[model samples]
Target: MKRPELVCPAGTPAALRTAVDAGADAVYCGFQNATNARNFPGLNFTPAEMEQGVAYAHARGAKVLLAVNSFPTAGRFDLWREAVDAGARFGVDALIVADIGVAAYAAEAHPDLRLHLSVQAAASSPEAIRYYVREFGVRRVVLPRILTVSEIKDVKKEIPCEIETFIFGNHGLMVEGRCSLTNYVTGLSTNMDGVCSPAAQVHYDKEADGSVATRLGDFTIDRFGAGEQAGYPTICKGRYHAAGREDAYYAFEEPISLNLATLLPQLMAAGVEAFKIEGRQRSRAYVRQVVGAFRGAVDQVLAGEDPELADLVALTEGQKQTQGAAGSKKWR
Candidate 1:
């Protein structure tokens, strides 16, 4: 069995180094600007930082993938162009891109550069994957987390390029590059602006009854009771009043994270070429603990032993996790 490469996240230079030292086969991150997803404050790297990060990861026998993954809006095309140029300049192992224009630019402008299709493009089938491979020379496709292991195996059989997938991180439920819940409420596009629930528009208030109300701009996204855990203020994960329901419930999606630790062997059997760990906006401590744990898990799996992964659940979002659509075909 071919061992899948362990791709970890690097929100900052320190996080990059931490992930590498903690057994990351490759570290992926974005620039400080709004060109890539996870464009949060005090995160991402500067040009000099990216150069240093790439050098750091390369020196330690690890690779660095730069994420210039967000779509470019009209008249803002140069921002994405400059990001691709920067990736080539810094010598990133691959550029993960979503926009077709950006992918074409990378292919033409830097013929020697490697291109990996981003999940934001959501190209799930063999036909879709082939189109990107033929048109843009995409060396790998980050399959949407919405696929079952059986589905992934089927897709791999027909596709020509490598299949990379999110083994851990954001519940792949939200249609990548298609989510507009944030835009509808905040007047900012997560796909275009590279932000979901931008911090500038988020507000929290404790109700007199002791429940806390989390609001994104004018809309109250969710309210948690005194004993309940308050999750992130994103609109998709919030509770809402359904038309026929008497009370509030998770109208869109719940606060569960994507955790495929238990399915490592199945994923490898499904022909996943690479396993990506999400969370570039997380702390260096998070990188060390989670990456180290998963590193151990991958090593054991590669050695033909059962991977021990229960310890990593402490880091899951809202202390909750799910296999998403990877394990079960009937998963909603």
Candidate 2:
């Protein structure tokens, strides 16, 4: 059995080091700008910091992937171009991108640099995957979380590029890189602006019933009872009343995390070249714990042993875990 690479998230320079030290085979990060999707405050790296981070990870035998994954707006392609250039100059092992124009730029400007298609592209079918690989020479494609295990196996049989899939983290049910719920409220784009449910617009109100209502802008997202834990106010995970339903229901998806530790062998057998862990906006402590846990799991699985699923419930979103679309289409 081929041992798949463990690709981990590194939002900050410190988290990059933490992931490497914890046994990550590759650390993926982005600059602190709109060129990447996770462009939030207190996360991402500066150009100088990325240079240092690449040096540190390379010295430790870990690869660094720079994410220039966000789609560039018209007349703003220079920003994405600069980000790709910076990644190449800083010695990133690969550039993960989604836009065709940006991919074209990278292919022409830095032909030797590796290019991996980002999940934000939402390219699930072999035809879509083949288009990018043929047009831009993409080395790998990060499959969206919406595919089943059987579908992944079929995709692998047809696609030429390597496949990477998210094994753990937020279970995104909405269309990748095409969300507009946040913009409806904050007027900022999740794909281009890289801010989802911006913290400045999030508000929580305490009610007389000892329940707390979470709001993003003027829209109430979800209300948690006294004993329940109130999750962050993201539009997709929010509870809403629609179609005459008085009780608020999850219009997009419930607040649950994807933990596929048990499916590691199945994924490898399905011809996945790498396993990605989400949560680039997470803390260093989270980076250490999640990376370390998955490191041990992958090593054990590679050695023909049964990997134990780590109790990552506390680290999960809304403190709940699910197999997500990988296990079933029941979520749809």
Candidate 3:
């Protein structure tokens, strides 16, 4: 089997360099604007920084994939078009895009530029995947975080383009590009604005009972006990009070990460061309640790050995991890 590529995250220019040096085959990042999903302040790259980052990664034998993935709001499509132009001028290896308009524009504007369908596109079927490959020349498709290994294997057989799966990071249960929970609370669209639980609106309050209340705008998302670690307030991963239940519980998905360390070999066998590590909102240290560990693991798996991966629980969200839907198909 061909060894799968270890695609890592690069939230900042420093993180991009860190990922390349840590053995990332490719590092995906976005511009410092609403054109990409991780539009949080102090992250992403400027035009100069992106050009420099692309050069840096190329020098280190690693590829840079620019994310022009977020939807272009009406009358603001010029911003997205500018991002695509900048990516091509920067000589990026590929453009990870979700919006059809953006993908079509990239394909036509820069026919030579490689376009990979972003997971935000939420295209998981053979028909849907084929449509992108047919219409926009999408070279690869980042499958959503909801498919099982068997399902992925089946889909790979029918789709012409390469398949990229999230091997680590967020266990995204909500449908990408369709989630409005964040906007419902904060009035900032996650799909259009590219800001999910915008940090500027996030507030933490210490309750009288020695617990911490995490609030996104005026609404309380979750409360953590003094002994528990507080998590970021995202609407999907927050705990809420349900009328049928007395105690508050996670109404959507819980705060946990996806760890597919042991499934590396199986995923490769299933014809996965790339293994994506999601966390464009994370730190440089996080980029280093996750990329380095996965680097060794993928190499070992390729060498026909059971990889011994480092303990990554501390790096996980809520200090917890799950194999996610990739490991099982209980509902289906």
The pairs that clash in candidate 1 are none
- Tell me how far the alpha carbon of residue 296 in candidate 1 is from the true structure, in angstroms, after superposition: 0.8
lDDT of 2 by residue, 1-332 (tens): 88799999999999999999999999999999999988888889999999999999999999999999988889898899999999999999999999899999999999999999999999999999999999999999999999889999999999998999999998865889788889998998888888888888888899998999998988888999988865658989988888889887887888889999998989999999999999898999999999999999999998999997678999998898888888987855
Q: The CA-based lDDT of model 2 is what? A: 0.91
What stretches of model 1 exceed 4 Å from their correct place? Answer: none
Residue runs of model 3 more than 4 Å from their true location after superposition? 330-332
Candidate 3: tens digits of C-alpha lDDT, residues 1-332: 79788999998999999999999999999999999999998888999999999999999899999999899878999999999999999999999999999999999999999999999899999999999999999999999988988899999999999999998997755987799998888899988988999999999899888999888999889999988865558988888899999999988888889999999888999999999999999998899999999999999999988899999989999998888898876422
Residue 134 displacement in candidate 3 (angstroms): 0.4
Give me candidate 1's TM-score against the actual structure.
0.97
CA RMSD for every model? 1.1, 1.2, 1.2
RMSD of 1: 1.1
Q: Which of 1 and 3 is the better model by lDDT?
A: 3
TM-score, per-candidate, Cα-based? 0.97, 0.97, 0.98
What local lDDT does model 2 show for residue 209?
Answer: 88
Distance (Å) between predicted and true CA of 332, model 3?
13
